[model samples]
Target: MGGGGTLFTYINKSTSHLIIPFEIAFKYEEKGFKTADAFIAAYTEWVGADVLVTENRHFLACHLDLPFKVLTAGKCLNLI
Candidate 1:
């Protein structure tokens, strides 16, 4: 963490290998967000974002195998 700040900016955005929101809408429902919101969340996870900035605490219910971190909007800003 040093004085270099967060390396979150180095995160990648996946154009391919992204989950199809329509194809797996039902599975996202288990996370408590609507289909549209779930799509965004799913994309965030697929993109390998360093942090999934969200105001929706319901994302905590997402049990998907995630490789990134999740933070509230405020928390994300603080890190920046």
Candidate 2:
């Protein structure tokens, strides 16, 4: 996940027409996990994008707190 974030940052900075897809990991069903909104919230703040896509259903439900639209699936082709 760290690698994906790093790559996204690099690609976004390097290319002018690149849309970076960021993954928000939710440890909701995992042990000792309280919040499943960390990654989405952080990335929304970090990138300031217009939209965010995730496969997790809980993320979409809790996306009202975020600035971007939490989509289920979308295209983000990295030219870099």
Candidate 3:
């Protein structure tokens, strides 16, 4: 299989996939998050995730209230 197909298979088999509701995403948007960030945040909250990893400096610096922790990829790796 090609790399993309292989990656898709791995994700399909190994990940706990979910669909985030529009209301939840919209709530984040109202809280000042951009469209993509809103969905990401909504998914994190909906899933009850412990941490949300990202390299975006703005997201890292934001003081928004959220249930989960946010960390850089390096910081997440270090915790492993």
Candidate 4:
């Protein structure tokens, strides 16, 4: 869910899976990370995403509870 910037390969995918939050307050309450990261995790879970593509170190931390499989952007490139 992290490749929204490069519109070439992901616009349609995002549009199809978009999950707009009906409520934002306390939506993503994970600590030790940015609000965006927490929200991404929550939203990914809400939308039933199987994989989360990103290179963020914080997301890979062992202490985090990430529901989806986390892959580096480079790793996704290799897999594709």
Candidate 5:
């Protein structure tokens, strides 16, 4: 949904829920912002909810510097 090097922030006011889902369809290089991290930060700020990121273990580990727990789920889950 965004170009490379562009940092975006999204906020949800209804509830406290942060979810980050990365799709395999998109090609990812070993550079730039990992979709997981971006989603987590944005979700956390918007909803003030905990973050849930479901993606390949390797990819998630490479991008996330903070502590995170992996969950088994699809990438097309509810975004907000």
Candidate 6:
């Protein structure tokens, strides 16, 4: 399996992860992040995750003071 396959498997296995509250995601949206991006970011913070793995450049480029680190999937895999 390749990176994409590994990532897909990892995500599928994380289906048991907790869902973030709407209020938390809404707060991120108010900070100017897109809907999905806001939700992802909110969940990462709410879970106290060490890092956020995503390819969304806009989310990564944001200058917001996020508690968790945002990284590309490749970077995340390297760390793992």
Question: Given candidate 2, what's the lDDT at residue 10?
Answer: 28
> lDDT (0-100) at residue 71 of candidate 4?
80
Model 3: residues with Cα > 4 Å off, grouped in runs: 1-17
Number of the candidate with higher lDDT, 3 or 5: 3
**lDDT of each model, Cα atoms only?**
0.63, 0.49, 0.75, 0.63, 0.42, 0.75
Candidate 5 least-lDDT 10 residues: 21-30
Candidate 3: lDDT of 67?
87
Q: After superposition, how far is residue 57 of candidate 4 from its true place, in Å?
A: 1.5
Across 1-80, the per-residue lDDT of candidate 4 in tens digits comes to: 46665422333466446655635314555345467776767666666677778777878765345566888888787866
The candidate, 2 or 3, that scores higher on lDDT is 3
What CA RMSD would you report for each candidate?
4.6, 11.9, 8.1, 7.5, 14.0, 6.2
- lDDT score at residue 27, model 1, on the 0-100 scale: 55
TM per candidate comes to 0.51, 0.43, 0.73, 0.57, 0.28, 0.68
Report the alpha-carbon TM-score of model 1 versus the true structure: 0.51
For model 2, how does the per-residue alpha-carbon lDDT over 1-80 read when each residue is reduced to its tens digit?
45545324321654444432343434322322235456445445556666665677666655365556666664444322
Query: Which is the winner by TM-score between candidate 2 and candidate 4?
Result: 4
Report the number of clashing residue pairs per model: 0, 0, 0, 0, 1, 0
**Residue 18: error of model 6 in Å?**
3.7
lDDT of 1 by residue, 4-75 (tens): 776576544456565555644555667566877667666665555666766765665564465557777787
Comparing 4 and 6 by TM-score, which wins? Answer: 6
Itemize residue pairs with steric clashes in candidate 5.
Answer: 11-46
Candidate number achieving the greatest TM-score relative to the actual structure: 3
lDDT of 3 by residue, 1-80 (tens): 55654311112322346667889999989988899988888877776666788887767999457887888989876865
So what's the TM-score on candidate 2? 0.43
Candidate numbers sorted by TM-score from highest down: 3, 6, 4, 1, 2, 5
The order of the candidates by lDDT, greatest first, is: 6, 3, 1, 4, 2, 5
Kindly give the stretch of ten consecutive residues in candidate 6 with the minimal lDDT sum. Answer: 4-13
